[model samples]
Target: MSAPDARPVRGKRPKSGDPVVDRALALLAAFTEEHRALGLVELSRRAGIPRSTASRLAARLQAWGALERDEHGRYVIGLRLFEVASLAPRSHGLREAALPYLEDLHEITRQHVLLAVLDQGAALLVERLSTLGAVQVAYRVGGRLPLHDTGVGLVLLAFADAAVRAQALSELDSPAAATLRRRLADVRRTGVAVFARRRPAAVSSVAVAVRDGAGRVVAAVSVVVPVDAARPQAYEQVVRATALAVSRALGARPARAE
Candidate 1:
């Protein structure tokens, strides 16, 4: 028989002391591209804790400057969190290596270009160059997209160790999701990612895996071109070449391109 005031629980149990801290983080996890802001009830429901508990946790987060209250009284991540998140080594390190080349590709193609890294099983855009006429991609710098949908996502998934790859696939529900295993296999075999326009062939993206010093894919470099002018083979060639140059900048020497 549970008491009426018993503590609410969700996710796995806290592995350490500071249950409040874990609950606070769980609340933070509820904010995603799909829902950047959440009311108290929604937050509590998503966090899987009691509303009273979530209220206390939210106050702590707000005080710590990790979250802010919106005009409508919903809570959203604050600039302080972005500042803290930026210090993550994977984001800053990969951006440092890819920024220059991303700029070059953007200038040469006069289109949208991006560099992304795999983080926590999602493709996190680290750098982007959006031209005046580039198609509207559903991603932005620091944004996370499914590893089973986007071009960089596939390449990142391809290079990931087996367990991570399996986990990502298991989360997708669309029929196309099943196709990713084969797509990733092809990417692993060819070291490049080629895709048609993300929106009704509005624009197509060509991507190549950028390797790290250990010959492992660390990031992806890509160019987005208008569908009308898309030449998949030509784009593939240039992107692969640029990716190799960037890889060299990072001291990765793949046998095929070295």
Candidate 2:
């Protein structure tokens, strides 16, 4: 397959000035969704390191199986990195518990189903399932979505600790913060969030919170569908059911009947 175009990496390089570890991490961070592979010069430039330093670091990383060279001799993220990432309890454990229900939801909707967790004040997508004819959406697995703007995000933010919510609110403008406060209150009251976005193709997402055995909200499950295809509320019940199923799989207890 043809390599995607290269783009500037997003985050700042570490300022610790550690020769080996920090530079190595910078090299890895240089690779992104659009720039998955890079030649020596591009890698060095993107990592803000000298070519010679990048070559040495890349060689070490390649030896450690954290990076690998492709057929075209460009450096790409290695399978070993994924293997290591798969051990992360937050993402991997949730994925294992939620995959079955997520699959069922995907089969039923034949649209986009997403599982995400709150990380670093944003919704970090852990898994996404979509079909060929599904409506276009900008989200990708491992991407971060705004807590104030997305359905899954709203569910997560609403159930987050008050301190966490306050920290997130501090980042937004007054009007947006007020709007999000109102929306978060609604999510807590209704146990679901229906969010619509107009850009990147008009779509609506219905999301519900997933809880663990301890009754702490841990993740959010969502379904994204074309706005014109159906009303967002139509999917709320099903999505909530799916989230409940996944939560049970994760050892969450059923609520006592009133």
Q: Using lDDT as the measure, which candidate wins?
A: 2
Report each candidate's C-alpha RMSD, comma-separated, in the order given: 4.7, 6.2
Model 2: per-residue Cα lDDT over 1-258, one tens digit each: 233433324674445646568779999999988999999989988998777778888999999899999999999999899999999978987999899999999999888999999998999999999998999888999999998889999999999999889998999899989999999999999899999999889999999999999989999999999999889899988998999999899899858530
Q: In TM-score terms, which candidate is top?
A: 2
Cα-based lDDT for every prediction: 0.80, 0.90
Which residue runs does candidate 2 get wrong by more than 4 Å?
1-19, 256-258
RMSD of 1: 4.7
- Any idea what lDDT model 2 has? 0.90
Instruction: Put down candidate 1 lDDT per residue, 134-180, tens digits, no spaces.
Output: 66776788788667767788888899989999898788776756688
Q: Which ten residues in a row have the lowest lDDT in candidate 2?
A: 1-10
